[model samples]
Target: MPDTRHASISVDQFIPAPPAKVWDALTKPELLARWWAPGDVSAVVGHRFHLQMPGWGSVPCEVLEAEPYERLVYTFNTTWTLTWRLVVEGKGTRLLLEHSGFDLDDKRDRAAFERMGKGWQGTVLPRLAEVAAAEG
Candidate 1:
């Protein structure tokens, strides 16, 4: 049998802003485009959208769960799911991201799992922090 084991990416980041601001950067399409892909993203369960990534093109996504400034869960592309949780800290928001549904036994999935892990930490989250911290 194949390994069939699953892998996931977890990113924890601190944003020098309130939960509401960070939440906006996640939910608001315009604000989100500054950090992430451009999409008609909404914090409403069952809402379907597509994110236009430069090299990746259009990625279909659907909102699964949304709890305002606390949590947001959604399906990315097809198999992967992205979950974001926000915890209010002393002077900012602590953002926790979990990207799951990686089948390590598969070559393509394994490569994506590895690359995205670094992408989230090195580029994505840092851009999100800057967008969330900006005065609006």
Candidate 2:
């Protein structure tokens, strides 16, 4: 028997803002464009959208779940599930991002998983924090 588990990536950040503010930044097109790619993202389930990845072009996505200022789950390029969990802590919020369902058996998928793990931590998360700090 061989291991048959999918690879996943997760990044956690503590934002000095409330869950509502963070939620707005995550869902609003203008705020998201400042940090991540420009997309018509919303908290409505089943709404299709695309994120303009700098060098990768537009990545198709769909909202799978939306729980107001709590949790958001969406699909990424029809390849993986991206989940954002927000929790209120003190006067701030704790954001946990989980990108899962990487097919480890595929070399290209594995490579992408590794690259995204670093990208989320080094680039995406930091930019999101900057936006939150500035806007919150």
Candidate 3:
């Protein structure tokens, strides 16, 4: 039997902007292309997205659910699923991100998966916050 244990990494950021502002950073392909990949990289969902990282080449992403300034969910490589939720909080908005579905026995790949999770925190997400704050 294949190891199917699920692992999820999530991040929450409070951006000093409205929910719509933060939501645009997620759903807009232009904004996504800006910070979807790590520095000097780019991404385009519903089309081919090539990453500089070896063994992590072009992958297709199908947008599963998109509720405007509320939620956006999509599948990467038809295996990993990522969901982002936005909630209004006072003068800012709360952004919740979850990336799940990875192999349990593949330790080598696990590190890459974990690094992607961290990327959302260290890179992609912070830029979203900055963009939102700037628009606020």
Query: Considering every candidate listed, which one attains the maximal lDDT?
Result: 1
RMSD to the true structure for each prediction, in A, is 2.0, 1.7, 4.3
TM-score of each: 0.94, 0.93, 0.77
> What lDDT tens digits, residue by residue, belong to model 1 across residues 30-81?
9999998899999999999999988779999999999999999999988889
Worst window of 10 by summed lDDT in candidate 3? 38-47
What does candidate 2's lDDT look like per residue over 20-45, in tens digits? 88998899999999999899998899
| Better TM-score candidate (1, 2) | 1
Candidate ranking under lDDT, highest first, comes to: 1, 2, 3
Model 1: how far is 63 from its true place, Å? 0.4
Extract clashing residue pairs from model 3.
Answer: none
Candidate 1 segments whose C-alpha is farther than 4 A from its true place: 1-4
TM-score of candidate 3 to 2 decimals: 0.77
Candidate number with greatest TM-score: 1
Count the clashes in each prediction: 0, 0, 0
CA lDDT, candidate 2, residue 95: 93
